[model samples]
Target: MTKKAYSKLLATATTTAIVASAFAPAASADSKDFSDVSTRYADAVSFLADKGAEGFPDGTFGTHLSIKRVDAAVLIAKVLELDTENAPASGFKDVPARAVGAVNALKEAEIAYGKNSSTFDPDSHVTRGEIALWIERAFQLEGSVEVPFEDVNNRYKDAISMMVANDITQGLTETEFGVSALAKRGDFAIFLHKAYQAMVEQSDFLLTVMHTNDTHGNIQDIAKRATAIEHVRSENPEALLLDAGDVFSGTLYFNEFLGQADLEFMNYLGYDAMTFGNHEFDLGASADGHKALADFIKGAEFPFVSANVDFTKDSTFDGLQNFEVSEDPADGEIYNGIVKEVDGEKVGIFGLTTEETPFISSTGEVQFQDYIERATEMVDKFENQGINKIIALTHLGYDDSLQYDNDLELAKQVDGIDVIVGGHSHTTLDEPVLNEDGEEPTVLVQTGEYGKALGTLDVTFDENGVLTGYAGELIKVSDLEADPVVADMLKPYTEQIEAIKTQSIGKEAAVVLDGVRENVRTKETNLGNLITDGMLAKAKTINPDTVIALQNGGGIRESIDKGDITMGEILTVMPFGNSLGIMELTGAEIIEALEHSVSAAPTASGAFLQVSGLNFTYDSSKPAGERVQTVKVQDGSDLVDIDENASYFVATNTFTAKGGDNYDVFKKAYEDGRLSEPGYVDFEMFAEYLKGLEKIEPTVENRIVDLNAAE
Candidate 1:
């Protein structure tokens, strides 16, 4: 889907919190005035400022100067929260008068002794190793990692080991801690900031919001995420759990059981509300083809809010109905918002799905309203109903340039919206991005694709419901222990899925078959080549005249690790259940369709194509409709130009032939009845094609050239 790249572990979480409470609010990149410091230390200086810590006496931060022993006492006294009022009598005789407040406080708090038992080296220059030692003592930190530093004094070696194990510091070099080097003003800021952040990570909070999006059948990680959610509920009884949709595709759990597996966990997780994503309609469009979506709707234990969905026009969403959470939910409250009384606070949560679903998914006879228009209407209605805090749960992507409207645009355009938890773009915000540029400050959070992360946001408000402060972070679902109850529930379901997934299909080359989410959606890959080849061969059986086949890059989910291939790997790579389609198109129409395919080039657009029986060249720097510079059809062993009026038969997925990914040219041809869907399923034939070969080694041969390649 989008960038879900994870970063470093947050501050060591020093406090004794629940084992499941591992959500560390990401360090904000807030800058501060430190004229002598490098920007690398800005985050540290900013954090120190947030804690009301001061700089040098000259009004400049003096980040380049070496820290002295008294300076360490004052900073550590503040970070460790030692009482300063009425300083206790210190056992040290060398303590200076100006530094007495800090030194006595530390000694009274039982965190510091002295250079010896009777003397405090208040004026001595602090060393890196000494600073590490003092920090460990202040935090009462335990656990140690072997350090290879040669210059560390034996007195502070254990302390250095403990700090390193806690991620407080890494050696200056792989083998050197620079133990005797003087600690700089910048270094002290970083050390104190990290300690302060860890101390306050879970102190307390008023309200909390936990959300997920584009889970895509990643049930395993959801097992651990459920534990995190449960811990959040226990911590704050006022917390609300939300999902922004697209819980449908990407694994055998979905393929074999539709959405039953994911829905079961969603229920177990107890989501308060959720919205629909385009992929939710991947299968449901025909009169009776909506069985999967209908079943998911029926299984939902939470409200499904879609202000723009006009299901009355179709029988596909037969049993679904709008929820009423208030006696007077405003004039058009269902369109405006769903009301929830969370800890005596009236919360308004509204839902909005992208209008592009009909073009990218199956909606059958259902119609979608303009997202921006509906969002404005709903926000006004919620406000009229006296709800000041509003949450918009949308399937609209977070700034998708290809779409007419995105989450950022919605936040800026709609007034009174406080928070936006969204999907469809699959963007991961490790920390909530605050958009204060809007009429009312709007906070946005999304936890990319798959069930890899669970996002938690703690928001504080005054009695009047006006948001005052917030802290947020994405907790990685990987590596955490799954809940016992959830794991037991998943055992039987997983066993059945494993039976077919682990079946040996064939062997792949010793190198990885790269179909990574972002790469496939943006460019060509060997896995894409293998997939397109299979589609061409399968379609050729029914229509030997099929000259070329195309596969949408978005349909490829993950990379196949090098080794013996399994049926499960193939399914993971091509999770969508799509059938093959044969169609006749004029050469001009084919070119027009290709133009639409590359319109969102260089940005991981799902419309990007993988093809067989043709080689084309394009320059994305050119205008959208003019990117395709060359087109050639394969003939025997040579390629030749395609005649503009010539009618050529092509093979592709049923989704693409029916206007998925904005392929209007294909949609027009399908409506003209020139397109016929063949009964062969795409992934089944793909598995057979891989097994047919002794070892698969499809290469990228510039079949779809980008003329604007870097020199």
Candidate 2:
């Protein structure tokens, strides 16, 4: 604005600030819900209102309204506390008088740059990443913020992270920061207030780290996540975004597109850095070894930082390098970690993935090292280079507890690390836990799997470079509005998924198959019975003696709501492509396996077995290995038991047959040649069996009972 207009605006803001300041302390921190905007952005809008930023003349915060570059520049000028007395300099060809000074101030300050030396897109819409660049530059951010945002354009990745590390912005979901989306005016006000506070606080600075883990190809809700992230970044450019890997598997999105849809969305979100999760290696031992991972890496627009995996031996990682500030992400994806500047503070970043990946997914020829050892080594490297603030982007499960892996274990074992963004174990650490149990205070945080939740961790370090204080929260992405642009981007891919998903497996369920992960894992449900029965049917086809079948709770990811069950819904519930195996187990081994199933009773475990052609009663209050109070086999409506030495045939999935979920007996049976492969794809078998019975109802008819009385 011109000098005169600037003075008038300042006077009005000062008066409003004074009036609002009186009640600001009394205003509860909870966001005031706005009907027009997505509930997810309520906090950003409410924060601005609390900070004395007036709404539109109509007395509403236009959250979904597009923000203009000129108006955005005014907010930036106000928050940076830039000088307004300078006369308007109308140098741009399309420059207007009111915005000339604001634009000039930002350009001179080197915070906002011109589209060219002669032009600034002052009237254009402000994008999430573009705003981050201006704000990061405005504050002279010298440290970095890194994330697994789907769309970290090479041009603005650094700026995006710079904003994150300074607590200037956040994300919609843990893995998305909405780089391609436009900002709103109400959010612009919130951004300025946060910047103003950060600018005013000189002795210490705050950085908000937004993180996510294990999305596993659930990109359908990414657009909604984009809206929430853009709203946050629009307000706080100095926020750090991160992902703990596993963005590569589970649904049709990955199976059909081969990570293309996921990669595009990540680029649109503008992540700074990401680590490798086990599922990233889910392409398995391929004929062309590292080709799948290579393709994923080659398409990445952000740095792929992983300190543990040795990709050097593989030609797929030929372009991998430890990135430097001078490198461009578009040239090729960088690997490992490096130092970055955020708000003039030097911060070092390192990446690590779980050593257990080979056991769970297919890493092929890739090798993994001890997380503690690699983390310590990386920390020493960063410290030796003089970067005190260290963040470890890791795929170690939140509390994996393996001596060689897990974020909690790393926190206690490593010394120099400040924060760990973690995944695996599908843990939901809604709050950042301070592991003062170690020599150095390490704060560890993780989000639950899927794009279901977003985590924000606010950390502050003193001038001495010691992490002093912190706060955090996990945001649910369900409340946000899906961005139109992101929705458009997913249209074609989504159409492909729906086409398959909607096809009738030519069957319907008379009773609801309760496939809820929590319930299925803890006890026997009708759906589990039906699934196991299907396996038994398939096993019978191979050998009539194969009478029993078992399905592990873990392999079942979702539940088919009561209705005509489509192949799509079945796949959604059982997304993993697991095959069936028919194996022999003695009566004694059967009892032992039943004991193992309930070993983690009281607390749900995916290893819990859902059985068919048999019934048993278990007391959850009993100790592990002793939970089965009774067991019996069904033989034409008759129950039989008492033959401990008799060998019986049973069917199960390849994951459990080969010892996944720690099925030691089954793995040992496989090793002994007692486990025979029937070669049945579990989901297809279920679909085939469903086709046999046009309308079937699975009944929970005391097949297996949970004896714990609800007192």
Top TM-score model: 2
CA deviation > 4 Å runs, candidate 1: 1-205, 316-319, 323-336, 502-530, 533-566, 572-711
Q: Give the C-alpha miss distance for residue 515 in model 2, angstroms.
A: 9.2
lDDT of 1 by residue, 271-380 (tens): 87888887787776445577788778776777777887777666656546553334233321123358878766688888988886775466777778888898888877
Range of the 10 consecutive residues with the lowest summed lDDT in candidate 2: 19-28
Clashing pairs in 1: none
Instruction: Count clashes in each candidate, considering only residues at least 3 apart in sequence or on different chains.
Output: 0, 37
**Local distance difference test, each candidate:** 0.74, 0.72
The clash number for model 1 is 0
lDDT of 2 by residue, 581-682 (tens): 667899888888888998898688999999998888888888888788888987777888726798898888867876889889887886665655423456
